[model samples]
Target: MASLWSKISAVLPLNEERFPLQFGDRVESSVVEMLKRSRRQLYSDSPSASRTLNAQVILDISWERLNTGTWRHVDKEWRRVYSYGCLFKVAALCRENPSEDEILQAVRTCDMSFLMGAAIMENILQDVVQILQSEIRKSAKDEDDSEHAEVKRIKIASPHVPVIKDQLAVPRIKCPSLESFNTNYLLPLKPVILEGIIDHWPALNKHSWSIEYLRTVAGCRTVPVEVGSRYTDEDWSQTLLTVNEFIDRYILCKDGGKCPGYLAQHQLFDQIPELKEDIRLPDYCCLGEGDEDDITVNAWFGPGGTVSPLHQDPQQNFLAQVVGSKYIRLYSPEDSDKLYPHQSPLLHNTSQVEVENPDAERFPEFAEAPYLECLLRPGDVLFIPVRHWHYVRSLELSFSVSFWWS
Candidate 1:
């Protein structure tokens, strides 16, 4: 077992060339401040809808590499070149036959790989800006003015999210549904499709998902994802079966990293011993008070399968793609009206608005939804907040590991 730094150092050579400072400058401080600002703007506490960046732990490497001397040599001569940068790579380092030592090593070190990488990257950008400012100062007055203006534009041109009110105007909220799951439990949880969820468990990978074999399969429901552009019953059945096969093949490959359908380094076998049980199946559990629960999990199979229409999870969630690729279409909570999620908790139906079709005639308000889209490959995790409506489409056969706990 090796610490996160040990694993990182193993992959990337670190020395004076990379870290000339006896103790590298604390670039993490700047990175954290920026992230905090961004997160605050993205999620402000509200009773109706709450969003926050709860996963604060991230891999931090800024202190490991930062110095003008480290990246000084560009040509033959050593020049003072402050090159600060971050690296983001996700992968399951220890899997399958990982020893106790390996697991212990990884566990002992707080899993901050993701956070560290982001911080390091920020440091690099800041370093570049400082270098530019210094160079501009040394230039002639006219040249300095020109360079300053150019640099200012470049800096300003960096991605800046609009104010929350402007972003809220993107999604058209319309035709509220009559029923929904419940306000106490706003999000979806691992409602295992008794059929697809256990499809990849080594013991049940080939097990029968037939209604007769597992009563749960029959009891489970496929909450209507879309209404107008419906999939033929035959097409839907084939998709689920295919999704099972895709997940089996995906985990079998053991390529633990962000691939087409998942996030980086998202391995579950090492964390949850129950998943390895001989009788592979998902057991439903609740995390909140009384009979009401907020989290649920649904299994998928095939290329066309997807999570329910764009809607926020009742609670915060970290959707870890265990197998296959999924395309995510995201909108802020402010755009809820455009997504048109059912307001009732009893019914799991959203507005039947075709995600591919924006017919302003029927759902005119949807035209406003500002969206950010990305694909989740195996081993990648998607962070979703409460009330942040989002849609998912499977690009390939896939299985997901969804964590939703208040």
Candidate 2:
């Protein structure tokens, strides 16, 4: 326990004299005073001093913003405050001899990747997971009288059929040179499946992902989950969950015919660098108009029956299937009228007519839309041109990575 506390103390910034934060510029005077009041009352000479500066106060402000529906548009300075608050609070909680459950809860409650502290959180999580995993293994071995205990494994697969009949299957091509791919597919603004690419990714080969391996590496980390069969439903909502709990509830168990849980369109790489190291970025992303940093990478992991309603993305997308299959149908932007897009501004990019179960009376014209389809499997990368409408459904317990570039 002393050693664990020492490791956590070594990871934090400790006392750098940045206490009593003052965001005077562009910050309201009232908020600035609140920040000052949140400072640590103790001036500890120990290197493992509490880092809980502004944590309590700023967290309240952030929570209020969440309840008021203004979290998305909150000022950047406020986000900076929130990030440090969460970061320091974790250090403070772990300062004492915290058990594994306490440590997990500490990390779970702290929201990460808000703005300024993404890289720091990545490092902190890696350290915490490593320490806890070592301790857990030691405990398990001792429980078995110094013998290895065989862990019972569950076979995970999707019960629902993920296939959909459509007019055309997207063309498949071996990965081409950047210039050749740009001239053929990118120039024509066409969708195609690139095969034999990403075969070298560690996720596909070495350290290949399994349920047990995932639980060991990232089970305790917190992530956003979309809770529903589909995001278009009235009951659809987003909630924060630990990876361990998500796996136990969604992946390890059979689908209960209720809403499915999914981690979709989240920048998980920014929070957990260990998982990020397993996949490589495709070279084709450079053909777009931005530098490497401009590219957007999102992780999509879920059980079967998870559906992404027909929608279009602003940038070109490469959906890389890592673990399981996905049945996909796509339509061009010219057929948006036939697709019956939602009238609301929030859903303007999404279609009102469900691709698989279209309402005949409300969306009679949707039947006329021309579309292409594909069954993306492991090592398969599907390219969707900018503004190309797409509907996706996971075939089984699936983990996919998508990169979008403009």
Candidate 3:
């Protein structure tokens, strides 16, 4: 019986020990009675006779109270009871063949403490919703199977490359006047690799900006780091660690098995102001319609194999390679339809097709897109126009700075 209970516990999201059943032997009867009493109390005083009580309503009420700061001063026991009711509704909704007995059993086994159990209940609800949505989409797709099949057949035979006569390379320029840069690249909305611009920056010449030097200066400062090779991976997660710890784990102690960790697109200068003295804003950025304070600067530092998936940014970017080489690819906004952007809200701006090893069967349209590719070395800055799809992969342990402006 104990082993059976352990198997059930592993399968279910509930914690049996935290929520002991109130009625030991009469589990089904007690659950039914408790639910009836609770429902009556909830709807009894309501004036609207047609008011519909559902799991979503319970979830909304609980979420609003918890997230909107309304329950901050509420009694702890009352909040627990409300959270328990929410969990009960979620369990009832998630069960495959829900019955009064089964739902009550699940609820009774769930942890009743709101603070401890709410996250588990929420995750369970999300999983159930995703399953239901997937079924709905599958049913809809089956209805249009013939049309989809025809489309797939056409895509398989379609010519892969765009009609452009020749591949274009991003122009590389040494230090140019602000006027020439504005006219040649900035106004034309074309990308250019700029050299000699960052030659005067103190970080280029200073040993204080080196990896060991950074460990000594900002070692204790905690920052958010990405703990996966790519953000698109299921195992990707963010965690806070000190600079020295990140260096020790991802940068220096790199066993072949170490997953990529990136200190990416973070405003590290604001957090550790002492590090900002290493670099300066380019004169070309001042030509735009913004004050010096309006320019947003961010830092990107990571070990080799770190990837930034194909995504577009809202503001124009000048990505300066400070430490190591990076391979970059760009697609124009005109070819966005060919890129197969993700429909999900979290990755809407990102392309679904992997640039490195694109599956031809899945993303046939990608082959038709004209693109520009480059390899950026130290002191090279690449101009990326706003909304242009760009992907980056670090070839070596790298530190790069990005300046964003209108």
lDDT by residue for model 1 (264-283), tens: 12222221222323232223
Per-model TM-score versus the true fold: 0.32, 0.85, 0.60
Candidate 1: where is the Cα deviation over 4 Å?
A: 1-298, 305-307, 342-349
Residue pairs that clash (backbone atoms under 3 angstroms), model 3? none
User: In candidate 3, what residue range of length 10 has the lowest lDDT sum?
Assistant: 157-166
Ranked by lDDT, the better of candidates 1 and 3 is: 3
Q: Every model's Cα RMSD, please?
A: 25.9, 4.3, 19.3
Candidate 2 lDDT over 146-238, as tens digits, reads: 111222323343345545454588988997889988999998999999998899999889867766667666776778888887899999998
Query: What C-alpha lDDT, on a 0 to 100 scale, does residue 269 get in candidate 2?
Result: 76
> Which wins on TM-score, candidate 1 or candidate 3?
3
Q: Give the alpha-carbon lDDT of every model.
A: 0.36, 0.73, 0.65
What lDDT is reached at residue 207 by model 2?
Answer: 69
Q: What is the lDDT of residue 221 in candidate 2?
A: 72
Provide the lowest-lDDT 10-residue window in model 2: 142-151
Name the runs in model 2 displaced over 4 angstroms.
18-22, 27-54, 65-69, 109-167
